[model samples]
Target chain A: MPATSGHAARPEASGPTGEPFLEVDRASVQYGSTKVLSELSLGVMRGEFVALLGSSGCGKTTLLRTIAGFMMPTSGSIRVGGRDVTRQPPDRRGMALVFQSYALWPHMTVARNIGYGLKLRGKPRQEIAARVAEMQALLGLEGLGERKPAELSGGQRQRVALGRALAISPDILLLDEPLSNLDARIRLTVRHEISALQKRLGITAIHVTHDREEAMVMADRIVILNAGRIAQIGTPQEVYNRPSSSFVAAFMGAENVVPLLVEAGGERLRIAAGPVNRAAAIPAEGRRLGGRVVEARFRSEAAELHSATAFPKEKATEDALVLDGVVMQASYPGGVWRHVVKIGEATIVVDSSHAFASGEAVSVKVPAEALFLFDATDCKEGEEELR
Target chain B: MSVLAETAAPARAAAWYWIPRAVLFGLLAFIIFGPLVNLLLWTVTEKWYFPHALPLEYGFSYWGRVFSPRGNAMGSLGTSALVACLTVFLSLLLAIPAGYALARLRLPFRSLILLALLVPNAFPNLPIYVNIARLFYQIGLNGTILGVVLVHTTHGLVYAVWIATAAFGAIEPELEEAARSSGASAFRAFRDVMLPLAAPGLMASAIFVFLESLDEFTGTFFVGAPDVTTLPLLLYTSAAGGNYQIASITALILLVPSIAFMFVVERFLRADVLANIGR
Candidate 1:
């Protein structure tokens, strides 16, 4: 893939071996003049669950629609199992999509809804019934086949939708936020069940989701999208721990941002002090720093808060960075106490087990391993981006 | 004692709260049904006098007169039924496709087409029908069932298209997407999903067209007079000639379907579909 495409290199574990089961090569979808999706390319390995993760209107759904052949791309081609299917209609693409709304036929019973595809294929009634029963059994909807979609609970309705899609046994499965409709508790269980089902069936699936943790829990590889382009694609752990950009870091819950000036010297990258962050010389190994000024980020839980006068100066800032701030407010969210600390003109959240007075002076220390650095100028910070 | 007084006072207030509503409802019922009761009384009246508030004698003699072989009421009713049915068929044949496009597709000048449908309903029908009848006369179609049916269809299409659009629009587009992704062709998806979901609304629209065509008078008069007379035309002639009994029976017959079908339309045109009207 070209570097300009904003795509991540294929993970080493799932490297390009032979051919991808579904390959979206240079797919560009445009609605009139506005480009909803730019020249996007993706290669999904057979039996791999890849999630297209992004905020709303970030083109994740657009990409899924294009892949499903519902919305044809203005440019580029889509290939499945090494065959060009860009011009084919959704029905001929041999991929089934489970819609977010479930989209069950209100007029039909659950059995008919699941067996509709098979019936359309001219399958015998007995065969269709047999397949419908099998899918119902797999999705834990065996006794609900006689019920209409409206009569089923939200979770059960979701399973009926899944059963309907899986009944066709297509080459690929596309899930468009199938669990987002369920209540929070139900969403958790359904998430696990879908992941287990995908693994058990060894089905190649592409899931679109705006929920970060949903993608983390359900997908093997997450394709992070931003502004109609691929920001990064990697395993959930990789993207969370080693995000390629500041936007990814912020999106992945490292929202507390402070600027830093850095110096690259042979084997070590030195982070100089600014208005908030202290000067720290850390190992540059495995760090992809390009510019002298960088944005330093650390999650709330990763930073340790201590009283300004009690903090150990001898610990040194050689490998760790510290910020001097005052505690603005504190709240207990279950296990830990979270505090909003005012550092210079900005506010950063810090979580510490030890209680601190609201107005007390404190210093937040983030170790080198926890601190994420990115080119400062590359991520333009604006007033509206404070969150 | 205080608690008892509070409970009793609220109970009394709540019980009397419905008094005004009941009176208003009674007034509305009277306004709607008073004329019908008079028409019904006339239909059965065997004899009456100028000084009598009610009929002096009551029987089904006029109904027999209207239904008998000598009466033209039955013949005119048959013509009306045929014309209304044809009007429904023609209106729906055009409306269904037009509605689907208006509801689902991004057709160019969509608002223009939707607005143009209102033009048939915008002006007084008498003048339009006069000009239309003149055109039909030139084409040798005046005084024929086909010409009246055509005129009724034009009137019925207004309701047919608008309501059908609302009905089809009320369906979730994702249902069709779900169908297509399940290996169904676009046409099959529409047949198996979109059509079934929109069926109730379309039925309601059809009923509206059917009822509108059935009760149509002015258009039928201008286009089908002297030959293809409908129930409304028959009613007009009897009422004008002071045969109140025959006219009342004819009106009661025309009203039967309207009353029956409005109930069905109420049941099928769901609140959501009703809310989506014109939008």
Candidate 2:
């Protein structure tokens, strides 16, 4: 990894205020012999919503908890506004966490749950009450002050959890998949509400979630973690369109893995003729392609389906991957017709407007822009460990 | 199935269901209230012969005699109440922290430690108390209120520690973490979230210790015989002296508080409160 990625992996991304408010300087966490979180360095700017995106056991939660001061980082320090707080307790750290389960005090009403932090700080009774009311109104929890957590619906409980986190007015808000408990229909509404609320308050937030779309829709920058190390950290556009590694490409919905043999080049790489794919050349002036054997991944919607009988030999020279295959099955999933195409021994999914019969031979043409290629030898070790 | 249900189900269900239910209800009512009725009769009976089915004379005079300041009954009741309270206090003081550790920490010998808590009850308590009394006698703790309280605490702690551990175990650990992230110190988090969540269970445990101490006779007699006069000890003496009325009144006194504690526990440990917290 480069020094820039080791220190600040984000590619020139800036928050609304253009200032780094929270800095996790090489924080690492270990559980006995196994390292759950390797040295992870990230600088979250002020008023920015940074999402740590990963699947389960990817150390995203550990990173969030370490930032929240619940877990101690084994080596590095965490800083907020240039103040070292690695040794501080969760209470002393200026961060409030909205737990996945909401974790509302069952003995207390919504009003008290929101006001609990204020009470702990020994704020004046009227001030705490006023702040609690304001938070409730901000989160649209009006007329639910006296209701216990059990009485509230899932969405309402989620808002109450958000309101409680906001009431403290901490420097950073830490969210641990708070919307995961909500139904899919309600999750969308809460997602937008949380994003808008964070922007409206201009408070920095670090959200931990495994939901790719949720992270894309809510965060200013997505920090994709894999195997306790940061695989990629960039804006949603950057990570989705220009992933750093094959692991990230597969994680970001590019599940169709196609192996290819390419010769390294400056402007255009010559894709060698293989058993599954034809020889072609793709633009590569800016891309960091290497090695003879390359792994190519494309999303279901990224590839085009066509008839294989009409072989366009001249199209191979263009900036696109042409794979010959036969359609195995097709399904209408809402608008697009999804087809399962068998390209030799490997099967891949491609979505097109028109449906192809099961036995019909097809061609999958993945454009260079939509196709993610990484060196097979460089990422083969990580590929087998992937879920 | 349809033929059986249509033809034979109703009569069989009625007979079998109602008959057993009625029998169980009768048995439960008798088992629960039968002793209380007998105690009531004994409290009011002024005079009775061996052959008499009921008390020949019933009056409120025994109640009056029981409440009299000069009567050992009132003083013994007070002593029993104090001893029970002290026992509960001491037992919980040890149980709460120990229970929290047992429930939350990943200790090496968790099951072994839990088994050790039951050690005081595992063996015959009579011989244990006899040895305890002998040790106390040498240490000058025998025949004092402290001696009786210490003795009762040994018994009280068995239930207290186990219940407290279970109570803490029943609460979600996330509640404490939530409190901590909400700007509460570790102690404050336990006091605010963990303690409140586990209160009902701990309350039930405390009530168990209280009742155990109030009715404790063997340990109390062995450790505090000459100086301490708890209601149970007083009842024993009164019964042995052939004063059946005083003994019955003392038992009644003991029963009132036990019933009251049960009611309190029921109200505190209502299902709705636990069902909704952090789920």
Candidate 3:
């Protein structure tokens, strides 16, 4: 594998008045023989919610723990508010971690759990009391001060865990799959609550999660990781629309994998799918030339499936984007019916308004811009690994 | 209709295993309790020889003599209680840290330490007593209550650590990590998360240590004689001196704590904890 370690410098401060609340500079972490992260670097602007999104073992959680000072990086340095905290212990770093399991002290009542960090820092009795009360009110844990963690429901336990982390008024809140343990319905509600809380407090948060949609909905920018390396870092919309690699494209929910060839010109690029995709125009230029179109992937929502019997009366060259296939199967998926159309040896799954019966001739209509093309070898490798 | 279905059902009686097990338990209970009852009968009776299956005579005369103001039995009871209490206390304090580390810490040499603990069990009992007695001569631990406690604790620490460590290890590590991340320091995390969770294990270990200290014969006989007369030592002395009635009474006395310890072990100590933890 080519080493793409050095790409861009630590992002420059946004004009004047911009200081990154947490900065991770070329941080690498290893546990025994496993290298969890390698020379990873990131910076979170003050109050910005950034989600480290990755499949498991992609070092997302390791990065979050390193920033929280739980796991010391083998190399590189971390700074919060321009102060180097590479050697500081977690409690001394002024950052709080909300664990995947909530980690609420089972022995402690909600109020005491919330006040524990303050007590550890040796705050005065009255001040600790005041802060605890304040946190209880803010978290809407008014009558729950006396309840032990075991007595609380999952959602309540989650709130208590958050309250405990927030009670200390941390500079940066570190959340490690904080909503992953909750049921799906409660997860959505808690995600909104956490996002609202982060915004209200104006606290920088670095959330690590495996769920891509959760990251998209909650984070201002999502950092996608692959293996022990970062694959892409962009705003959710930017990453969803224009993934740098096929890995990110699939991770962003573009499920349709098709093979295509890229023919590049001065200002425009044309892509031709191997009997699977219609030749479509993509906005690619200097960097995309000279590669055999081995594979392409499109979102299911991006392709339109039609019966091949309705193939246009025009010539194949004139309808360069049209392909013939037989509808193998179809299912009603919510808003529209979805069909799996088999084109000779290749199969493209597409969504359609009208249902096409099995064995019927069909053609998948893929808009030019919705298609994502990648190098054939890399595409095959990514697809195989995902499987 | 099918050979396979016909062959699947075995011809043997399903209840065949129960009868022998019930008979075995009955025999076991008799064997365990019969001696104690014989001793109880002998202590109350004046004399018994080969001719009579039952005691020849019964009276309160032996009990009166044993509990009389001039008797040495009460003094032996005092000595045994003091020594057992001290041994349990000291052994518990030592076992807590060792057990906690063995249970929770993933330290590199944990297995080595555990092997070292088992080393004492491999030593010959007589040589152990002689070596300990020689060491006692130098440190003035000779025949002293503290010396007896020290020896018992050393002998008992293995069982204590093994049992308590299993208990501590059975507690979920997540609870401790939760406490720590919730802002408790390492020490406080153990106190808050681990202590309550392992309470039954600690109690079980404590009861075993207490009973072992109380019933100790070889160590106390070598190191605690002439001065510290624990109940077990006193019973041994009476038995050796041909004082059958006093020996039987003392034996009965010794059985009480052991039985109590057995009850505690049965009720609270699930051997499953040890099985899972040791593996």
Q: What CA root-mean-square deviation does each model show from the true structure? A: 3.3, 3.8, 5.1
**Every candidate's lDDT:** 0.87, 0.86, 0.78
Deviating ranges (above 4 Å) for candidate 1: A1-10, A307-316, A378-387, B1-31
The CAPRI classification for model 3 reads as: acceptable
**Candidate 2: which stretches are off by over 4 Å?**
A1-10, A13-19, A313-315, A377-387, B1-9, B12-36, B106-108, B269-279
lDDT of 2 by residue, B1-279 (tens): 998778787887778879888999999999999988988999999997789889999898989988998888878888998999999999999999988888888788888888877788789989999999999999999999999999888788878887788788888777888899999998999898889888988898899899999999999999999699899999999999999999999998888998999898777654643343221
lDDT of 3 at B95: 89
Ten-residue stretch with the least lDDT total in model 1 chain A: A378-387
Ranking by lDDT: 1, 2, 3
TM-score of the first chain in candidate 2 relative to the native first chain? 0.94
Residue B97 lDDT in candidate 1: 86
Native-to-model Cα distance after best TM-score fit, residue B84 in candidate 2, in Å: 1.2
DockQ values of all predictions = 0.83, 0.79, 0.38
Q: Pick the candidate with the highest TM-score.
A: 1
Share of native interface contacts present in candidate 1: 0.93
In angstroms, the error of model 2 at A8 is 8.1
DockQ-wise, the better of 1 and 3 is 1
Q: Estimate how well candidate 1 is docked, as a DockQ score.
A: 0.83
- Across A1-387, the per-residue lDDT of candidate 1 in tens digits comes to 342124453346443345678888888999889999888888888998999999999999999999999898988888988899999999999999999999999999999999999999999999999999999889889788889999999999999999999999988999999988999999999999999999999999999999999999999888899999888888888788888888888889999888777756557777666666666778775777766667888899999998897556444387788888999999999899999999988899999997799999998988888889887765445212322
